[model samples]
Target chain A: MLTSAQLDKPIVDSDLQREIEHFLSYEAHLLDTNQLEAWDSLFTEDGMYWIPLEHGQEDPVGMVSIAYEDAILRDVRIRRLAERHAWSQQPPTISTHQVTNAIVTAHDPTAGTLTVRSRFQVVEWRKRNFLRHLAGGYVHDLIKIGEQWRIKLKRVDLVNCDGVHDNFELFV
Target chain B: MAEADPNWVERLVEPARVHKAVYTDQRVYDLEMERIFGQAWVFVGHESQVKEHGDCWSTMIGKEPVVMTRDSKGDIHVLYNRCPHKGAKLTAEGCTKHKPMFRCPYHAWMFRMDGSLVSVPHRHGYDGTSFDPDDPQFSMTPVARVENYRGFVFCSLSEEGPDLKTFLGGAITSMDNFVDRAPDGEIEVAGGVQRVMQRSNWKIFFENLNDTGHPIATHESSFLAARKTSKHKLGGEVPFQLHIIEGNGEAPEFWESLDLRAFDYGHSFMTAIFHAPKGKISEDYKAALDTAKGKEEADRIVSMNRHNTIIYPSCSPHTGFHQLRVIRPISINRTMVEIFTFNLKGTSEEYWQRTITYSNIVNSPSSTVMVDDVEVYERCQEGMESDGMDWISQHRGEGRDNLLDREIQSEGISEMPIRNQFRAWSHYMLGTPASIPTGGGDS
Candidate 1:
């Protein structure tokens, strides 16, 4: 499956590269620090965050995805996580995420976008030991906002995304 | 001799309730495969999954590896994955084209898709003996019965039982309405499959499909956080994400008004939540329906607003969401749920995307809503293991279940659904072939 030949692959300049690194770092910080508020700011107003249920998923129109979220749904999830009575968070998950191999593999300078391929390993801990190693390529679509750069879309493709999961409390 | 517990099952189940041991006991888990999961009409993959010849999908029935395959004649066959030559697994996992026959990895014994012994490598060795390949015992064993309803394939392991249609009974409507929502009045297996493992009893998950009492209390923290985030993060303007979060926090009256109906075989479905304002996509979808299905038919289809319809011990079809969470009990303490997304045959692509979106937010491993639910289920498993209490309560609105012909109705928060399931559980555990209670004498 050609994953967004135009979208999955983008062009990145040095400035764009720097912007993506910061965007990637900030996104990780928001989730790891449990500062979902800050993370919510990363998306474009109409941007989508989609996680396909199947490998090599091509289109999202008629097919069902594992997760496809707009701004509103994303907020609800963040809200649910922060709720004091959230039963799953009786002992909230503690995680230290390591984001590595940030490469600007593709760029779309005219579109103001760049796709970065990166590997990540997050060690998440809760009451009992739940440590998962997730390595994925991140497709980042960025747009310039005056001097700052904001994330339009950031899709993470986990290497073992197809495996049975317990629950994704925090981000990868 | 490590004889299986014959009386252990009888002791675990009661007329009106079930002991948690039926859920968490290892000895009982083995018996379930032989009795319930083995005999019951368990759902395999949809026919669309293996539409072509040599196409096969491997899944488990209890502890057995049952393969749903398409033969050369385009007939569907469910066969045991074992090869008779050396007792080796004949096929790899997932769907794969095995050509005309499957060859065992150990000693090469090839079998046709219909589970016939096509060859056994050195056939001359068996010529002197009575190991004739034509005998049924020499071939891969086919399931007792296989039936398809609206492209959904279900197989039963027992030779004697009510056919799949009679077994599905009223639940067939859910599958019909499932594909009928497709403008073309058909649906296909599409998108992807999401699998989630739960550290609790399979019954607990089944009960939660319509368990209205827990959403407010169990999901309080998540919804509260959703509310708080709207206030602090995005200036109090709720989005679809936040809407789903707070949707779980509906008022008690709202829950009480909605109808919950249970069928004889422990199958049940709830009327859609009375809230959730019709949004842009839904409005667009309604317009499309008016064009495709016309005003009356479309209205009739839309009027059947239902949540999850449990097909009893196997899967829960969310008609509104266009997904099915197929449950497989891996062990007494663990259950595996595979989420399959379906494409409405004639609807626009965007309509399906919304369904997928709902699946991700509500059912995905990273779902904020389901995370908390999974946690509580695990907690229940842990709590039940302790000797503090022997019986898990199902007394909520016990005697108050409203009875009707072929169906029982209860209030939104009533535990009648759980009690209804236990009624079936007792029947199944007691080894009664008629698991569906007649609901007349002593129930």
Candidate 2:
């Protein structure tokens, strides 16, 4: 459990901030290259990937969401992307995630937990001239395991999270 | 617009084959809006959506914007969203609690929740003019008919058609089972609505609701993914999340073993392939229902597990999961689906959470299972645009259907439901009186 004061305190260490920024950029590279399995490895065993359907939606269990996946569901999603019969991926979606404005919102070095917030815009295109622009804010909760950082929770708050969308085959 | 020849409908629809023009022609689509959607009973919203007095939820019936409101007396009404003054829309979108009355934003003209004109600013200026406040034209105009069956509200744009009950026909049992499974014999639309846009004809989505054959092929990617994950992690014992997705990969024999029933007015349903397995959630829910409605009634209610019940031209309700996917046709090539999850009144919080989970997994836009389904629908739409094929086949198990007095039942893999829908479609397109067949065993 994190205290309010701990969550509000920003990490002033420049080295830690650079490290977190590099980690996010690497994750974005994995997603853009469609290396979903490698991307999945960035999370802990019980990590969560959530996309709230409504703005400021607090609870995933009580409300519907664009996505709310634990490790098992994430595995299913990754596996589906590689299936030959996945008609939606017949012409696989190509996306370039531009992650910017990285900031270390909170850090508790003794607890091995750091919270980072960043803004991202993902431009995606697929066959049949289907193109979409997805812009959102990402809130990542990371925990240091030894010298390595693993994602505990990754929450995406899209500008149009609640708006009607076509198939969302790939991760944001 | 020139009048479409009556033969056009008959030429487009056959017993087991339909012309691609029925799906791709803009003229036919427009005629459908006037003939089919104009006369059929379309679902507006659930009564729970506007529970309190002065609560309003805006939705669409055909192309017309409609507002479902609850008056001060708690009576629900469905009125056109257009304000009588300057034709401005009453509400922008979504639900709002406008206590007492609704005020038009264009002018200060106010109207009761039931669409009765309340008052307008400077009313004396219109006393001698053509504007008459007493006339219904001066206020919001209500749809021809609005009816609620077990808290599910439906409205018809035309006044000459059959009532909601008659239009629902034998498919009303799905509604009964939905509410009856609730311990308190009711449900409320909880959790928020998830909307998805499909680049396909509305009827294509409707046909796929009872399409058991397509699941194995269309959803191979999703089911295979779930199977792989379950085998690797859970050691072959699939959990609830994977179970629903993997069920689509069932063999042809499994689909053939299930039952499919089609009724009048394009309504149909397929028996649930996956039952609520023996688990803590099922046990607790059953116990609650047993306590509320006695063991015998609870057993009966739980026994009627249905996968998707098509209300025809409006929505599909999954009674087993307490979710409704309402279909709103945007154009000949585009459609919008709004998914609403319902909470059974007396169930445990865990039980209601299952509804949310099922909806997010299977119905949400990002759902692995549904993305493939939407993809195929889009592919069908794209393929139909080509000039290569004139007719789409519906010949699977055509003559094998057992046509009873009231409903048509066939093998689970039959295309009887599609043919049955066209039967209603042709009837409506040709402007024939709808006569629901009566006399079948209530299975």
Candidate 3:
């Protein structure tokens, strides 16, 4: 329902495309380096981070999700990760993210909003030898404020979102 | 006949301590699959899961793959998920629509929604053979017994035992309160299911359901983090999210103040840890319940708040939160936990959303609280394999429990529930009489 004709129009503005790509790469860098507090600052005050439990899940409130965090809950998550007694993170998870196929799917110049879709694959290692590969598609709703973009919503749809999973200790 | 020595099964459990073999031995797990899971009432699925006719959902009762289906006549059936022609599973582990008939992918053998064989391809090939379509063996076989209490369905693999109601006994009140909390006196399985794998024995997780002493020790990281966040950001008046986590760090005296009740057949429940907070959401939910039922009845209903009710060997229901955690054993050292959230019909959307939020924060595998518990359980599984210890202790307030007619009441911090579980475990593992033991308080 949020689709628009701008999806077909290739982003002709090279400057805007470069800025969007830089923003995504920087976000991935923050996540991979465990800069969660700085990463949290990239979102608006009312921003949401969601991981849908099912494919094509549209409503987080009407259904369940793997991860749905607002600002307060996200802060709690960051705090927990830093706790000394957090046993699951005794040897904290190390991750590397590969992001590609970034596309500006929609743009509303008057509203100062743009929708970007990208594909990502993340490899995480923890507990000395345990490793996992997570592949997903990311959808971001960014609003421009004073020549900078802030994320209003970020939704991640994983290929195995509905599969039985082990403890997810860090952000994907 | 018997696999292991009968005396050894009895020796694995003692009054105040149990041997490590009960958890680490594959021989014991096999006997449990036969005597315990074979006779006990295990949860299959909820009726809401298969509402429409020909809707089928595959799940496991013990180690067997079974399917729960709704037929054209609105009758529900629990059948084995194997094709009679071959031993292949008919469907995967999920909900699917096989309207009118189910055609086996192996040989195209067709069967009705009720698991009756309708037809098979190349029927003339079996004309001279002993295969008869009318024979019961040629059709899908149902479990020994299937019973539905309210909308929840349970099946027993063995034919001889107490009925479902008798098996549930006094603990049935928890199930009643679960459904009656709905304004319309009904609830449906909604949202979605979240599954997590644990590297521990299934009984270890079951025993933890009512163990009040471990929350502060196991979940110290989560609660301390929440407390720090509340102090730094929210000025120390914790919100609902932080409140849930912080409550786990309650002092030992606080936990001792609450009461624990254990019923027959390894069922038990503890008093609510935190009362329903006073807020707009609570007010609105109370108003809706009052509108559906009178204020007096509504007051009576919500006042019966319980924390977690263990239905023994299958599922644990948190009535106050509208969630059920189903326990499925994979192997001796592996377990699967499936959490399901329910929606009370005729309630406000905001109420249901709160339930979903609770599930995400408290029960999901990504939950801050559960991740630590999972780690501890895994550590327990690994530690028991060492040669250092032989018996695990259950000596915390062991003999200080009151025995009633059909229930056991003890201090919330007591290990009465774990001891009581071993009582039922001994009964099942030894193939003893199913009748409830009388006048035995503590030994």
Candidate 4:
């Protein structure tokens, strides 16, 4: 089971809190503006983007998931979205993600790693008529390399994770 | 029983094309729900899903609520998921494990796993009424017929029809090969299920299963992305992950080289375009298979590789990938697809993991490949609403199908499968027997 990082202590450092909040907002901004390539760049080389189908899904392998993608799979999706004949994206799905309630549960100063949990609600509009409302919880495992914090894992647990869904053309 | 138009269905479905009403009209959809899905042996849950006594798995057989349950005697039965008194569903949707007995939340009516009425809350209230506890009407009703072929259970609403084996006809080989690949000669439904909703008619999705002509055009975006990623990042050696995607970019000649076989009852399958991945995990899996069922038998089982085997309007099983996609038609313009990945028993954990990877990459709604297919299906549904055309064409390779005793073989890119499906559709809707139509290539 992939659990959240240990809760070392509540982040009392104002500077560290501000940096984490900025990073979360910027990530949401990239997704909202359809800057997928830039969003992809925010991840580490071996990072994973996972959306578990089960509520408390422990293993991404040996079980089915909505998504359990590595860098190559993520890049393939990004490249396909750029294709002119990508039929699903003909009109393009426009989304606005509202991410809030970010709580830094754990911060390892020595290893430069942090585990942050946030809540998000995304409204996606497509085909000029269909509007989908999706809400989920996000868990990010961030690791700092040099000066920048890169995502080692981004786990999304949707409220309706076990329900039927339409094709998700874009990342949530 | 009376005919509304007498010729309403026959006029719509011809040898080469079908009227747009078949895909768009609500009347046609209603008729199909009653005729085709009502009579055909539809796939219910597998036996493994309801292995324990009192375990129940709920699903629909053409919008009819039904549940598959294992009784105390170890026999599995398919029953209508409704309360005998109030007509409310017996169990909630999906699987409910170890359900001691079905206690209806509606009226507190209880039933055994075999659907026999056990007790009711107000037992003394029906003293003088026609509600005889010993009568069959008081119990949950089982479907007319239930058959389990190698643990894959199927149900038919109508009592009279060809048996499951006969209905499957030449397509039975696909199911046989599916179970034979298991090291222990058994496979079970495992992992989890992913459901995808498509805003299109159910037939459109079925037609696309063997429509070899579409991949090169429909899936160009995904295949091209896979190629670019392989070339730049993976040093031109496509891994199994990208190999499945890039395989869609095969040359036109490659698709034509495939062997396409269409059976009676709208069933068909295409020989796999993907070669077995040459990797350590796969090698170990093959060795295990060889050990279980002698080397020669294992070789024969592995050699029968296939991509999509359509068991007609219900499910499509990919024998090579260990995936089964169940098709559920929600309404006229809406369809729900549930994908299930199987675990071949006695295989390594890594072998099962590969199945999970394949499902996540190819069958999930979030798949880069299926999104395009779903989009085009929706486009066809929307375009059929246009008054520009009356008929959708299936003229490719029309006169070139090879006639056989029970099945037809055609070129991979041929539209024979679509035509064959309409042939079955006309039979079901027109109330004709499912015996091969005179001109439909069956001798």
TM-score of chain B taken alone, every candidate: 0.92, 0.96, 0.97, 0.97
Top candidate (TM-score): 4
Residue A77 in candidate 1, Cα distance off native in Å = 2.8
Total clashes, candidate 2?
0
Candidate 4 reaches a DockQ of: 0.86
Candidate 2, residues B189-299, lDDT tens digits: the string is 988999999999999999999998899999899999999999998899898888889999999999999899999888999999877767999999999999999999999
Q: How well is each residue in A13-37 modelled by candidate 2, as lDDT tens digits?
A: 7788889999999999999998898
lDDT of each: 0.76, 0.90, 0.88, 0.90
Model 2 chain A poorest 10 in a row by lDDT: A1-10
Query: What digit string (tens of lDDT, one per residue) describes model 1 on residues B337-429?
Result: 998888877676667776766677777787877887888888899998887877777777777777765678888888888877766665566
Which runs in model 2 stand beyond 4 Å of their true positions? A1-10, B1-6, B436-443
Best by lDDT: 4
- Which regions in candidate 4 have their CA more than 4 angstroms from the true location? A1-9, B1-4, B437-443
TM-scores for candidates 1 onward, in order: 0.89, 0.96, 0.96, 0.97
Recovered share of real interface contacts in candidate 1: 0.82
**Candidate 3 Cα misplacement greater than 4 A, ranges:** A1-9, B1-6, B433-443
CAPRI-style quality class for the chain A–B interface of candidate 2:
high
Pitting candidate 1 against candidate 2, the one with the higher lDDT is 2
Which 10-residue window of candidate 3 chain B scores lowest in summed lDDT? B434-443
What docking grade does candidate 1 earn? medium
- Candidate 2 all-Cα RMSD: 2.6
Give the clashing pairs for model 2: none
DockQ scores of all models, one per candidate = 0.55, 0.87, 0.77, 0.86
Give TM-score values for chain A, per-prediction: 0.81, 0.93, 0.93, 0.93
User: What tens-digit string does per-residue lDDT give for candidate 3 at B388-409?
Assistant: 8989999998878887867888
